[model samples]
Target: MKQTQFKLICTLMAAVFTVSQAAAQTKEKQIFLSPPLIRSIYTADPSAHVFNGKIYIYPSHDIDTAVTDNGSGDHFAMRDYHILSLDHINGPVTDHGVALDIKNIPWAGRQLWAPDCAYKNGVYYLYFPVKDKQDVFRIGVATSKDPAGPFKAEPQPIEGSFSIDPAVYTDSDGQSYMYFGGIWGGQLQQWATGKYQPNGSKTDLQNDDAPALSCKVVRLSSDMKQFEGPVKDVIILDESGRPLLGKDHDRRFFEGPWMHKFKDKYYFTYSTGDTHYLAYATSDKPFGPFRYKGIFLKPVQGWTTHHSIVEFKGKWYLFYHDTEISGKTHLRNVKVTPLYHRSDGSIALIDPFKSK
Candidate 1:
């Protein structure tokens, strides 16, 4: 009887051990799968690039503030920039700390929105948009010797640049161009007459049947300091080649412009602001009359969606942000997932929360 009882006790202990081991394995997998890639702080508007063979993310540092959301984007309240980097796609991300701050910029008033970076002649140029003392948004450029930077801002905003969300794309042959502008709170509407109007329409063109406003693009000077020529409009067209109308909220360019080249074709992707989608358009040339492609990313658990597409180790990845962690639009978190391009060139649609 004693031996039988001892044997029963041993079996129970073994069963308990197995159950604990299985639970631990499940926890490990959950940690690896959960996102907000950098959990130390709130971040948004990820501008990802592969620099020196490492994936570097330049994102707006979102801060908790009492300011309320309004037509002029007063609630975003981003005051600094932080750079995040990773050695591998799913590997650990390192926050390199503040790259630039509002206090250091000589001409900035507030709200340093989405920014992009470009590398040329051994320098990294950080291009951002902020309201000036006159309360108009103007694009600005800052420089750093390191991709993970303690960057120095140019004393003035880019001479002819206006609006927001500056995305710089450098072509294979070596020239670089900047695509910028946004509607609604980004104040793209205020510049409708090609000049800043204090009483300009609070939103877009406002006529639903009218053609939507166009984002602006300009070739960068060799020094990467200023625009080389006049800023031109980047037109987005429908399947029939007609301009997408203002009523098409799901397809029109609202804010957050990103340009990436895949298979020698230029893909211009932007946020469909009110609709909360990441949509793309394709063009044969860098300066585009791009044909609108369907949505690539569905609405996330956030009111805003901004992203960047980059290739690392021959695999494509999409870096974007959502309000999943903080559950507040003004406080966001960045996330990443694999992005696949179909054989016919259309991007495979991504549902960010769908289980793999």
Candidate 2:
């Protein structure tokens, strides 16, 4: 089916179900026109991929806070990941449960944040970041043969991953890059007793922040185990080539670095916090001089907005999460909507919560 026709059919099917008595049924018995994609539990930080004709989503699973909340200063305290897949755009979603868990990872603590997956040489690599036993953040790589599977994670994290939100981008020329980091704030440290520690200041977060962070992009080696080159900093630049993120620059990356290749351009996208919004930058080169484009999605109805974009079968969709159903910032549900691009290569802003 063509992309346009498939979307129209989906919209029509959703419309049909809302007019009937079936809408009043219990959560288990009800027929939903557009239900939350994963019904069993809250799933956030969606990373959608097209693998072997199926759309597979690898997202951080948000369980109830009672299980583990070690006072990381953040509400989200995820311990495992679930890989969800759909056969087609309008098909039912299947949850491939517990692809990777922290119990198996010796060095990992609680607080599993955003994760992304990439396929290379018959191996599916699940890249994720989690706080260590000491409450410090780091990124790790897990491997699986099947798209949805019991992925085996490396005992330790990637050599020097002291950040969050790991997003992997495999370019057309067979080169792969990993983009990861947090917002432009000083790295905060805390005691296991939920108290802030003093005399632990390392890097000051400001406009003059080091080039290594502020959204760094580095080339990955063929084995996908280590970095291959100098870590390139990706900050928005002014017309005269001066850095523009912390000062004057409207769209600085808070977290969630997603790299997409549209036509001949590289779209470097991320989410901004404090006042959240989904935004992007474009560049001709993968190791970018990425100029900041305007916001592609105004913040969803949530405290934090993290997303990944994928084009499946000629249709483009933005995979993001929101707290509409859960009513709490920590318990977020994933949302998907069709995305369009302007003729000039900029993406059109989308409201993910708009009614069908």
Candidate 3:
């Protein structure tokens, strides 16, 4: 055979080998157990829960990348929330559509951030945050009979809400607790007055023992709208039993407050910005004296890290977000992976991974 013919035959053989290998790999992987659980739209701050025997997620819908500068998408300009669900971990993700939009919110300005949901009696309540007409951050609650709702927001914001990121937990005994708030020392005093006024708490710039930012929790009245008791500060301690504070501090509560009950422990978790990581601390009670264990998820490729922990069937999982799909810093997609706990009940560090 001529040299040209020999070279063509060699090229054809190489192409055949490559095609066969690609087919084999595709057959070996399934999407059910992979990362980036949803793909149709960019989502962030995933709060997963099982309701009526099915898995549902409440996530903030990120603003479109087209309007962003050079499509960098470096700002959180979200104006709505989307609820998603799955029949099983391996099943298809159902887009329940927009549950709530900021435009319909009479008093909201923009920037809808991390939200959560809880089922009480027959009502499904969505707890979320948005900037008021004045740009002050406030938390609010909306209700719908269906888990995936065209939820109706109460005409006014939760009377005393002034911070962001709301997570609701209902105890086994029927008592419901609402956990919310983050950063800024001065807001605590405003929080105490049931309004956002500057006269409330004072920010201490130098105090390491009591950082300006702390997670606050209050008992929710049966209505899920009113505070049942005084708002109390939840003190988070570092690994050495010291207080975590300051922007540069490893244990500082930058934002995102989530609570999960496992066995007999209540886990209080949050994201420490500046060095984004999903860190947690456990306490015997819902409100803590939580002793910081350590970081479960390392810093993600994005600037913020927020998550929700849930147990479905018998396996535990962490649901978070990253910019992998959009390639823009602010427009993120939700992802989840199996989470494991050590013998002592402390969680194991989870490294991020992608699914096929």
Candidate achieving the largest TM-score: 1
Model 3 residue runs over 4 Å out of place are 1-34, 65-74, 184-212, 354-356
The global C-alpha lDDT for each of the candidates, from Candidate 1 onward, is: 0.85, 0.72, 0.75
62-160 per-residue lDDT for model 3 (tens digits): 877444332111257888888999988768899999999998888898778889998888999998888788767788788999999989888889876
Scored against the true structure, residue 84 in model 3 reaches a CA lDDT of: 95
Off by over 4 Å in 1: 1-34
TM-score for each of the candidates: 0.89, 0.81, 0.82
Ranking by lDDT: 1, 3, 2
lDDT of 1: 0.85
Cand. 3 Cα-lDDT = 0.75
Query: Candidate 3's error at 90, in angstroms?
Result: 3.3
Scored against the true structure, residue 214 in model 3 reaches a CA lDDT of 73
Residue pair clashes in candidate 1: none
lDDT: which is higher, 1 or 2? Answer: 1
